[model samples]
Target: MSRVSRDGGQVLPFYAAMMACLLFAALAFVAVGMAGATRSDAQGAADAAALAAAREVRDNAFKGTDLLILTPEEWEEIIRGRRFHTAGACAQANAFAGTNDATAECAFDVPEFTVSVTTNGTVGDSVIPGTENMHARARATALIEPRCFLQPATTPPPPGGGGVVGIECRDGTVIIVNPSDPGPLYKLARKLFVVRLTD
Candidate 1:
């Protein structure tokens, strides 16, 4: 009877220890899942924010921002072939991140138009005792790529059948005047850039 009582006491303690371990494991798993969810949310916010900023740059620059007036060489020196508004692009990033419950840590200052951001809120429900304050962050990139390639006609069009460089042939072929022609190419080149997300 004494043995049984002693063994019973031991069993209860051991069982309680096992239960405690299992509970801790479950909590840890939940915390990890919450962290992952927060990370993905941050990444989504970053992606949206970057795209917004890139689009802002694209739309504004293509439509003849003050920067466009500068010579291509000067523009390249300033923005590395991609022109964007620093303040306006950051504003767009902020707006996008705000909608996603995140905050932009930096503006679109990279030469290639990249941005980084962090979640505004923590993974509040992280059950782990030490990780409740952890924040998630992410980065994203966007591009304003040229959609059109201007190629000068190799051969003259049929007599009286052709016009200027803007005209396109029936076979999807188009004539591109000399870049230095000092005519339509300069005015129309800006239209070629199409906004896209590179990464």
Candidate 2:
């Protein structure tokens, strides 16, 4: 009976230790999963902020431009993602991040807008120390790519000045723009530029 009791006591300690290790591992996994979820949320916010900033620039680039005075070269530049200002674009990034429960810092480099975001909420309570006060951060970049270029008339100029321009697009679509009218140019500008996120 004494021998049997000794063996049982030894087995009980081993089983208890195994259970403790399993509990610790499960808690660790929970903590890791929480942190991953927070990181994913932060990344989503960053993507939204960056895309908003880029689209803001794309949609407002020709606000004050006089399309009638634009030369073919200038039109080419516009289609190449130039002639746009970064003013008010970061505000858009901030607003988008806020909508996702985050804060954003935006940087503009010509056709690209980079946004870094931090989640407003922490990872909450976890088995990992210091995670309760930790917030997830992520970065994303969005690019404004010009999809159309000015295709000047191949024919000779007429006695009267030409009032219409031809724009050739990447998708094999040609758009005719009357420089005297701002409506078509503005609408065409939106189609000429495309905003997308980068990994």
Candidate 3:
């Protein structure tokens, strides 16, 4: 009976140790899950900011030829103002904006992002050459930082894995001349745009 009691005592410690290990493992799993959730939420916030910035740029460009006339400094100021206003407003609306890490808050959790505009003014060649005009092109790019824990799981297996998201618009005037040729001379423009996202 003494031997049996000693063995039983040893078994109790072993069982207690095993339970502790299991508890630790469970806590670890919960931690990882919460991290993933936070990452996903951050990414969503970034996406929203990026899209809003792009749209603002596009809408402003569509207003007229101001993009063509503005000096480099003026253009930069305009772009920055538009970008920050849009981003700030959107970020303020989102719950995650100011709570994250310092770096993330500074960038609105978008580590790398871009906004660009291109304008082209040209004279058309036509039967009545004097009746030609100008054209303009504009584009915007916004790069968002990927969420830490969620990217690996959600991103598709490679080849061309990652890309950007954007939007574009163009406006110009046209002139008609020559009854026979009926040359319609005007501005011709095109835009390539994208908007990136993760589920």
Candidate 4:
């Protein structure tokens, strides 16, 4: 056989294989990045849904304030408030999910005022095969906690019995005054609550 240089041709297959691997590596990196983005999007949706669902309690709480006085039993309920409706709260969650281009599967833990929402939104057009079917999902739970805390009157006065004096020491600021304050009774009965995501 003639001593023909085969160096260039010999490296061609090796270089081609390396190029293919590099291409695949790049593709894999892109796919992972896309999947991460999808997951983040899903998480955002789930968080929003949970919060919106929990806020369903807020409107009802505000409505509950319409009553001039929250009786002992009613006040007890506010302390252990159970105001959210499953269907209405889920509706809020679904609407929030739709805004984020996701669908929500929501569950309300009544009495606890916790809303758990799972968001399902696919990350589209993944470069890797089979990854297109990846459905990004995330679960988030939110809680509604009341802000008002009052110690019941210890001693009942004679005749008309008694009424709330005031809720003392809000952050060390004694919220003094009798029940005469327009806002105090309103604040007590229809207290605005705070919503926070636990997971």
Candidate 5:
């Protein structure tokens, strides 16, 4: 009778090694996929925030002006409500294509809101050339809101009451002010407005 060979045990180690290699490869692939997905999500969020900020500027801030005028506190308030942390406001004075116009650039003095959100998941990097590490930026711009007038006074005249006077009434007209010239009311009304994001 032939004796059983002791070398049979070697087959078991070979199979085990192969299994381990396959498992490691699978894990590596999964890790790569997860990183890619996170980057995509961050990009989408950044784009949305930028666009929303711009819309706010257009709808409420830039009216009949060459640039958007927002105080540091006001800018922070608007950005914070939109889920963005603002740093400060600044004036962009560089001469560049498409951005040479004052209206094309935004100034940020703050550290947080002025910073850019990168695909690498870092926030607060300036988009400016020499100020790259100084601030972050989100730009929004549009024409002025439309215009509508309040109704004329309707209060009755004293004594003889010849005509209406001092009778304040809300105008039914919905004034659509041009995005360029929002006028004085723009500043006041913008304070009450908030920005919301959608999927």
Candidate 6:
């Protein structure tokens, strides 16, 4: 047996310090990752909420209006993105935000729908102080653009009667709406509008 070297105890302290550094680095990385995930969640909620609101407005544009009596000028106005109902749009935004575990505040300005969201989750138990209660927030806007145009009929209808007309879409799809049967046109309201998320 021999006496222990003095360097043995010195190496122990060095190893202990190295382990502490590594632990701290790992905790820091975790904190950063948690914060990033929270931010992403908030952004996703905002985008979905905005898009949902826009889609709701676009879908309801044809509601409460008699499609059979739509004049050429009225059709033009609708296809020009100047007509749409915004009723119940903000409700849709809030519903979507709830689905994504967030809360939304929505605003509408013509064809644009803006939504802001705060994530339900926080960056919990992070290395940084007070980050455990930090919640992420984000905002998004969506637009509803009309993709179809009306091709007015050459011949006018009889008195108090609606005639057949063609709706030409940007995708080269032509929809013929007949006064006898306007069901198909009513169902294709989604094709008439293009809803998308924006900056």
lDDT of each: 0.64, 0.85, 0.34, 0.62, 0.35, 0.83
RMSD in Å for candidate 1, one decimal? 7.2
User: Which has the higher lDDT value, candidate number 3 or candidate number 5?
Assistant: 5
Model 4 global lDDT (CA atoms, 0 to 1) = 0.62
lDDT (tens digit, per residue) of candidate 4 on 121-164: 55556567877677887788887775544456522122333454
**What is the C-alpha lDDT profile of model 1 across 64-138, one tens digit per residue?**
433223443433332233544455777888899999999895545443467788898887765576566778999
- Number of clashing residue pairs in every model? 0, 0, 8, 0, 33, 0
Off by over 4 Å in 3: 64-199
On lDDT, who's better, 2 or 5? 2
Question: In candidate 2, where is summed lDDT lowest over 10 consecutive residues?
Answer: 152-161
In order of appearance, the predictions have TM-scores of 0.68, 0.90, 0.40, 0.75, 0.35, 0.90
Models, CA RMSD each:
7.2, 2.6, 25.0, 4.2, 14.4, 2.4
lDDT of 6 at 114: 99
Which ranges in model 5 have alpha carbons more than 4 Å from their true place?
Answer: 1-7, 61-115, 118-199
Per-residue lDDT of 70-178 in model 2, one digit per residue for the tens? 7666677777877997788999999999999999999888798999999999998977899999999999999999888777563212333466777788999987776
Q: How far in Å is the alpha carbon of 128 misplaced in model 2?
A: 1.1
How does candidate 4 fare on TM-score?
0.75
lDDT of 3 by residue, 1-199 (tens): 6999999999999999999999878866665564455445445444454455443433332233322233334323332333222334233323222232211222233323332221122223333334234222222225432111112122221232232111112222222112123122111111212234332
The total of clashing pairs for model 3 equals: 8
Model 1 worst lDDT window (10 residues)? 156-165
Give the Cα error of residue 104 in candidate 1, in Å: 0.6
lDDT score for candidate 1 against the true structure: 0.64
Model 5 / residue 34 / CA error / Å: 1.4
User: Candidate 2: misplaced stretches above 4 Å?
Assistant: 154-162, 182-186
